[model samples]
Target: MPVSLVILAAGQGTRMNSDLPKVLHQVAAAPLLHHAMQAGLSLDPEKLVVVTGHGAEAVAKAARAYDARCDTVMQAEQLGTGHAVAQAMPLLAGMAGDCFVLYGDTPFIRPETLEAMLAARARHAVVVLGFEARDPGRYGRLIAEGEALQRIVEFKDATDEERAITLCNSGVICADTAVLADLVSAIGNSNAAGEYYLTDIVEIARKRGLSAGVVICDEAETLGVNTRAQLAEAEAAFQARARAEALDNGVTLTAPETVFFALDTHVGRDAIIGPNVIFGPGVTIESGAEILAFCHLTGCHVSRGATVGPFARLRPGAELAEDVHVGNFVEIKNAILDEGVKVGHLTYLGDADVGEHTNIGAGTVTCNYDGVNKHRTKIGKRAFIGSDTMLVAPVTVGDGAMTGSGSVITENVPAEAVALGRAKQVTKPGLAPKLFDMYKAAKAKRQKDQA
Candidate 1:
């Protein structure tokens, strides 16, 4: 049977107090809603529907960044949970499989729990995924009798006894696709919140003699964010999990808590990550590579045995080959450094390629952007670019070539040749001191006349 996931992202999230949709807030370098989509993807749903409201345009834009062909369902009016799911019904018009509904704000939900619920789903309908909470004060109460659930009583409607019940609801359930469509239609928006809740279907199912099964999961897996504080907590949780995974993969982090990993970063075995490193998406570090403290890498690759900065920045399209050393204050973007390359202190190499065993000296900069367009600077093998040199692109330094310090190379240098382009040095002794004394003597004369 096919499975279609209906992700609810239509809520305005007033509690977040920001114009940007709460789902777009990042956790581990990706949006929270995108993380929820990953959980949905894990189940391999046949189709996906993202219901959008509030910032509909922005939400739809974010959906484009995720996998699966997403159809945006417009919830023009902020009615209720049932209404939000109802808007997605048109997207699932011809679908015959189970329709799995999930909240976008619930980013930490584990795929294992969803798989468990699917496994427990029955032939026609099954309202599953619940747990006995240690503190169920704010959650809806789950009233189960024997092997079946009686009803999930909302907190507002529940009496004192039901309110004290420890068995709480997770609000994540799967049912027959057609049966769910009909059940959602029957839910009326006559409750305290004036919103037609999907949870009402649980009680309606019990009344119709349909069995409501229960599948329990760790409560932590169901945590959702509604405010900035909650967002911070979610970020901390995600980072913690990411660090733990990196450690388990044979990557040694000096201070795991100080290291931040993106959701899709790949680290090879025996790689060492120093403290306070921030890894953005698409970053991959090969085995035996060492990244020193305060390094920020985004969409880049570090080859085996390569050593990156104590303070280096590697932007998108940056690739460092084996045994490459990018020392402190080196920023590389859209550049490739071949094996045994050493790009030492304070350099910027963007849209360029540095050859094998090349020594790029301190403060050397490849001025790639010439006001209007970006140009490439190519350096051949064993080339030596001297300290404080500026290669104004589009320029090339040939194999075994050497450049003098403080030189500004406008033209390409031939193989085995030396290039030096700088202002001629001249000395003027005593002139500087004579000028200073003249100014001081004038000031003294003026002060004496005034007295």
Candidate 2:
């Protein structure tokens, strides 16, 4: 069955005490809204809509950045969740599928949980996600018998008996797109809060002889961030889960708690990640790759058998092929190091390509930026770049070439050639002591004048 998602992101989150929209706040290095959208995206939804209010433009941009096909609608007023869903119905008009109402602040909803709700749609007209809360607190209570959910009672409007129910609503619902649009249209805001509640759809559907069901998930999966403290807790929760999953999948984390993972970090089996390694968005380490402690990697790929530093940064577009070794204090950006490339300490290879088995000595730099435009440096196979060698931009060292130490290479070196672009040393006899004597005389004169 085709699926569609309507994510509610219109809340101001005043408790968060920030001008940024609540859903734009990050967890796992990605906006909270992206997490919700990622779960929905796993279902390959036919249509995706985000209802935005506070910081609508920023939120809409973030949504489209994640999925360009996503459509965003403006919710000018903070009416309620039902009103928020209503705003997206027009965008989803004539779409035939199960429409899921998701909360942007809830970032822990698993894809399997949503699939379960879709499966439950086989027997009921509406399926609401419910959790057995450890502390129900102010959450709406789910009134259900077995798998059949009778109605949902808001804590503000619930009787004392209903308030005592431990099963709480998670604000995640799935129903037929047409049926959801109709149910939302029929909802009214006459209750305690005088807000149109999406929960009310249950009672309205039940009264119309349509059945409603509950799909239960872990209490942790229903965590919603509303405040600064809750945001911290959410971040911790995401890290804990990510670390555990990495360990379970055969990836080695020397210190799991100290390693923080972004939303889209992918490490293959047998890969070793040392302590305090932070993975930013779009990093992938293939099997047997070793990332040492204190290495921060973002938007880079480390191939099999590649080893990165104890203190190194791989910025966007940095790619290391199999068996490449990048040592400490090395920064690579917009560069590719082919197989068997050894780039040791104190090197910056940006906008360059090093061929297989090439050795880059310490303090070697590809001066890629010429103050106005960036250029490329290409080092062919088996080349040797001597220490402190500066390969100026738009230069190439050919196969089996060797560069002299402290050389500044401005032109290309042909295959099997040696390039040396430094001035020859000249010997000076008895010049050091004479210069020191003159310096001492000048110092004495300056001291006498000051007196």
Error of 2 at 329 (Å): 0.2
The TM-score values for the models, in the order shown, are: 0.92, 0.96
lDDT of 2 by residue, 1-451 (tens): 8999999999999999999999999999999999999999999999999999999999999999999999999999888899999999999889998999999999999999999999999999999999999999999999999999999999999999999999999999999999999999999999988999999999999999999999999999999999999999999999999999999999999999999999999999999999999999999999999999999999999999999998999999999999999999999999999999999999999999999999999999999998999999999999999999999989999999999999999999998999998989998999999999999999999999999
Provide the overall lDDT of each model, using Cα atoms, as 2-decimal numbers. 0.88, 0.97
Would you give me the overall lDDT of model 2? 0.97
Which ten-residue region of model 2 has the weakest summed lDDT? 77-86
For model 2 the local lDDT of residue 419 reads 96
Deviating ranges (above 4 Å) for candidate 2: 430-451
Q: What's the residue-level lDDT of 299 in candidate 1? A: 94
Candidate 2 residue 332 Cα shift, in angstroms, is 0.3
Supply candidate 2's per-residue lDDT for 367. Answer: 95
